[model samples]
Target chain A: MWSTIGEAGEFGLIARVTAQFPGTGDVILGPGDDAAIVTAPDNRVVATMDLLVEDRHFRRAWSSPEDVGRKAVAQNFADIAAMGARPTALLVGFAAPPDLPLSWADGLTEGLRAECARAGGAVVGGDTVAAETITVAITALGDLGGRPPVRRDGARPGDLIAVTGPLGLSGAGYALLEAGVLGPDDARRLVGDSAGGADPGWAACLREHRRPGPPYAEGPRAVRLGARAMLDVSDGLVQDLGHIARASGVAVDLDSAALVPDPALVEAAALLEQLGAARRAPVEHMLFGGEDHALAAAFPPGTDLPPQWRRIGTAAAPGPEGAVVTVDGAPARAGGWDHFG
Target chain B: MWSTIGEAGEFGLIARVTAQFPGTGDVILGPGDDAAIVTAPDNRVVATMDLLVEDRHFRRAWSSPEDVGRKAVAQNFADIAAMGARPTALLVGFAAPPDLPLSWADGLTEGLRAECARAGGAVVGGDTVAAETITVAITALGDLGGRPPVRRDGARPGDLIAVTGPLGLSGAGYALLEAGVLGPDDARRLVGDSAGGADPGWAACLREHRRPGPPYAEGPRAVRLGARAMLDVSDGLVQDLGHIARASGVAVDLDSAALVPDPALVEAAALLEQLGAARRAPVEHMLFGGEDHALAAAFPPGTDLPPQWRRIGTAAAPGPEGAVVTVDGAPARAGGWDHFG
Candidate 1:
């Protein structure tokens, strides 16, 4: 068995990794070529890319190789989903030290294959190289299915801003992990509280942080239902909403009362406070927590929101104070998640 | 004025870099969204990705930020071209240290924009992240113009192998650069020879090493001309030909007499020898040296080659031994590239 990537060498490792993937419906050509061809039936390809650098984006001490690979693909696919497209292809560029275990690479490939299949995409093509640190760069391509691309600048004044999917579990999960409530072991070993392992809510946060499940199908649904502007909440809700507001040239005001955290998510916050890791309240996490990959969009005024979506805010004329996004009529500070910050 | 990447922050850097890119034809949407939509007129998108890691794939001490950026993009676009496609969109995932100069980042963006324009592609969307070393991960999308992709496995026994574009200049150039003959000072200071700078041949080698100009158009032309198998000469000629030979399940025989090096390229090898940097003959450079980004293809027997392509080899039944690619009736060793090796 190949022990390290150095022992397997580049071509050998590539052949082993790519052979595991089963081609999906949209793939006209798969790996082992100069490039792979994927069907973009709407005459357009929706594309986005994201990077996960070791120690900076994820630490081996915290997440498994599978978690890293899945997270890298999941986040980028969420962008395609936000564009009202269905994921079709994934191209990954992986750089790691030669000393990295071959088993680790296999796990990463398995994770990429599983996630791409789950999102209805195929692993198209990738390049592997040696680097000082492990870096996973993923580009996800999607087909818009003939619908016009849903954009952030489409929101208009008097539009109802709605959200779909869980919002703060990832953030709460991160806190739990950082607080040592969940560590190298699974959630079963909650320090000094083994019974807490039964809490599906707490476990969900941990799972979401490792691999977020975005509402991919809901993106196209929103577009079909006449939704105007949309984006995935990869960054905090406030910061991401600020993007829509600025792009749409409007002010967004959130109804904090309408923003209800899942009772289990609130329980996660309570648990974080129990471990003295709660820097913000549970509602704050719902408002500002990021990486939930939740779809947030603006529908025409009075358009019936899908049962899967919750109307959490409204778009209006720009406020005089220069704040594009506000909560309960007050300008809300958008914090968390800045690579350079 | 902005100095380092940290001072500009992630969003500001993204905005600054993206602003330099003028929109191209195939782009349905540009940056500043979750994802960008690109036209894929044939309903198929040719996709490929490559990574350039600092020190591993490029050295800042030797290559300017612009050179690194151009090389990263050129290599990936070459892959697209090899698929018989025209490059349409480019998505970059850049991870760099916080202390990296913002001007360097700007220069990199300028280079990416310049190359993408030359290839007729638009800068779609990308992510910037913080990492210890600079890594440029590029995913290129291309349109096949309704042509079936020219694959490596299509070659048959009796197919004539042909090559287009200059070969081994990059390898010769790399030797010159590594030998202290062409360092710090652009070709202006050629170590012990000042007059050598006036020689365009030597300068071409240096320039080609920094930014390869693959004959991208020739790829589609080869397809149009009924090429059965084709690939870009990224690794050495022997190494890359081995890919086609193995994939097509045929033994390949090269006619070294047909692979006459460019007079100028041969001059570069002589200059490297003059500087005591020549590790092999000029012809050997063409044989085992790589990174020329030239197109090599297998055409049907009795087919006249386009003026751009020169017949250099022939596909034959597999020999008794395991060697798939041979030179002058003898097994040729395939070396030069293996990230792990």
Candidate 2:
């Protein structure tokens, strides 16, 4: 029963949002000041920014405000994790229509706080303004914890390529959403039916589509274990591996057998089949789906990977055509989501 | 002729934009990586963010792509400066339609780089995405250099209130622009007429309206000289001072005679009069106009002000109504631009 943003006023809405996120951890100066002061401790700070635009990046019809907010924070924080840095703080710039409900704004703030908490960071500062469309721009700051950042250009020949979290689940979820098997109304109902364990696979994919749970801690762990190069699987695994390949002046060959689908994805495939979807191999989704947010890294050959890490590929000297990424010794097609494509 | 973003493709447009901003200064890792790494020599970083939406915060007809980019960086950096810090790096999140001209994006990047150089910072990282409207969200990170941040809550009774940059000029320029006496076409011509010094007053006002030159270095200087409290005059002199007064639990009394307008504003008034506009005191503009980005600070009583700083008022114990700011012994109205207002 909250009033709209126009009725609550900008300052009033800001106060309400700030109250929800009291300063925590190394934040010397939090919101309500000119700028937030964050303790970097190591004399270096890792920073990344991302912009999510309505309809282009997300649809209000499909995502609740909370889902939108969580996704915004998650993706940006994933970039920081990709650098093998522990996220410390975030600054959000949100713009939406004046007539939007204040409850929606509150939901968005709660979602942001929840995601930042999961990433071991806090929402230190932000700005909100009125605009015709909803736009969320987030800047995530991270602490390297006295470690050198794991850059994409540092991989060498004979490195082992690995992944720390699930891939292709988000892509499968997106496919289900796009096929209208689980519409917005059904998705909202499913969100409330936590105890109704019916169709767990469908629910898991839908949840992944709405809010990704990136393995944030594994990033710094990989760096600590001497990861030569690393990045997040935001664009598909093949596309992002191609980036590391190009940056490191090497070629990567991913083993198709090693790119195994998780149990949830296997269930999601069955659900899609029951829902009359065309029998496309779920392995295709595993290879090309975007927004997985899994940490992909290259470590020295014969290095012991942590239990959570799974070997998926190997890096080698480039072939005749400069740097390339292949699947089972064949050059893989570079297909991934591009904003302007 | 440059192709549109859709035709050029996202990666091509990004390459074009990134080429304009080469990394400089304390940037350990610049753009095109997973994230940018910046040195925070003092072990702390001052961070602030701002969002500018097309038509809501600015008009494409009025601001060139370059002006828009510069203004976006300038305003966010000014917030860091207001905290008594030297800006070190910037992260930009830009969202525009797919059909936006690639040349415009390149011009925006060039403008951002120029302004960041002025503020002694570099555009270390950024993200560009497709959206329905053009939106620029900039996050500025700053170094405090082992000095304490001059916060808005530190003002005390008997402190001298001062400003380090011109006030109301941007406001006066906005008035002229709104009245159509200085239309966008004329303003563009004025920008190009660098050597044509005729009507210097009109040209100055127009220039200030397009791009404000805030006293960035003076912020840390004020802190070194023991500024009691500080903030930027972004939301009008009276309104912003009121924020300081409320935060410090004190009252501020301004001498109206000391709130002097520059000669250009006086000339602008005459021009508006000749244009048959409603006759109003230009002082109102000085007290209420927004987006100036001038620094306002409170110093100890009887302190010798620096050459650039001008004392205009004194802080005192709060009046019966608690914290307040008055002009010429009259309580000033708290009227300023609010996004939702």
Candidate 3:
């Protein structure tokens, strides 16, 4: 077994991590330099950053190091996808306690590389340091491929609202995890079992919570098909839609019956109820729970929708109460993850 | 007085910080979106990231929030400059306790904007989250301006080693701050005073420790002047030079007598001696102290060196011992900051 990070030292640990990520053709220079050089190709780049801190953004008791790393990269890459851009590279800055096990770090590097490969990008550079707690910060860069970036403010009053991925599964998983119905250790065990022995639906939610599978390819598809406005569903569907509402100066109305929760979420909720956990309706989770990484976009009225996207709502002119989001002709509470609050 | 971050909430604090940074021309799309879009005119970008954790990379008791912010941006920007690129934009990820004072966050934003301006860039976007401790991670992007990057492996046997910017001031300052010779409060007071007032040398060291001013323009200048290889002296002069020597497969020999210590560092050393602090010679500090953010490059021998670059050494064929760097005809110990150790 390898020693702790303190015993392994910085350079040795860096070497171990870098060896896990092979250089891609897009990277002119990779790790071990003062900086990495990457091709932008389209003469413009889209960039975003996200921070994940232990206990605040994640709990070690609930999440494995690999899960944490995947979530960190997935969230940042989702931002790039939301802009209708294809991700090019990622730069990561990581800090953790000196006494942390080397296996934890290696697992994290593996997770990072796996997610970047799924997102069609590479980890170009990174920095590592020792701190009191584990913190992972990722900055993702994307190429627009000569197309104008799809922005939230481009939505118009008559646009159609749609999403390209499943909703509320991550939130349902969180509720299950919080209730102790499914622990992280159990999820890890299920990962190796091709067919989850007893409850596949619950197992699916657990996997989604650990590593979200965003529809990265759907972003460019939406752009090529003329997406008018776009954003990612990170802080709940209602709360995230509110941003588009305010930015585009329009009201968004979702048809409650049109909004269908994933079948896995329904199964997970049923299992939680059977386990004597407090039952949160799947629809409630869809409205208020976050971290789905689903790409939401507004298309021009009468535009042909992509097969991956499902219509959930429509945009309208703002009412006297100002630009807002509503469900089934009633105002939905704007509640979601609030970092400071 | 304004309340803490918890009282202000994440969006409110974000609004305050974003208001401090007006969008620059390079930023096609600024904050409040899923991601930001910046023009990358050169079709390529140089990228790097760095993490600053409270108490490990900085201490609230020893450095102000503004200083911490400036240092974070400056160091990452220095990495881009060391690659012979001109910085164009920055994406920052900040995490802190919810109860942290809003004033501290605001001061940090101001500092970030100030440093980006100095480096000829803009804070295009960022993410803010709550955590147990303060952690600032910055990813900087730069344009190569149609020039090839000066990498670490490009030096030849007959190259002259040179440096652009002051050396060891930050290390001496670290010594003073560690010794409590100049507290954060005293350093703040000295910022407004132009005269020596009680101890100017200690004050200079404190400033350098808080914020570094690397020769950003000199990096591109060196590339234009046909420099063979380059990097920033981040982890002490000797330790950083070893990286170049190892990469280029050559032995670098430094002339110790040619190295000059800054007058402020000499004065700081004398003051520490008077105060009975452990006596570390100024020359020793110059050779071993780190975090100066100075540019070190190798130029073709007999090249007309720029006035900003001072000759320090020469590159030669690898020695029989397989050692890479030596000083004054003897091996120089490679010692510098090691975060994990």
Model 3 chain B is weakest, by summed lDDT over 10 consecutive residues, at: B187-196
lDDT of 1 by residue, A109-129 (tens): 988877877788878789899
Given the true complex, what DockQ would model 3 score?
0.84
| Tens-place lDDT digits, model 3, residues B6-88 | 88888888888888778777888888899999888889989999998888889988888889888988898899999999998
lDDT of 3 by residue, A134-252 (tens): 88889999989988899998889989999888788888888878867465345435344433356676667878888998888888889988898899999999999999999999999
Cα lDDT, model 2, residue A283: 75
The fraction of correct interface contacts reproduced by each prediction comes to: 0.95, 0.90, 0.94
Tell me which of candidates 1 and 3 scores higher on DockQ.
1
Give per-residue lDDT, candidate 1, residue B223. Answer: 93
Off by over 4 Å in 3: A183-197, B183-199
Query: Going through the candidates in order, what is the number of backbone clashes in each?
Result: 0, 0, 0
Which pairs clash inside model 1?
Answer: none
Q: What is the TM-score of each candidate against the true structure?
A: 0.96, 0.95, 0.95
Which structure among the candidates has the greatest DockQ? 1
Look at candidate 2 and tell me the lDDT of residue A145.
90
lDDT of 3: 0.85
Error of 1 at B319 (Å): 3.1
Of candidate 3 chain A, the 10-residue stretch with the lowest lDDT total is: A187-196
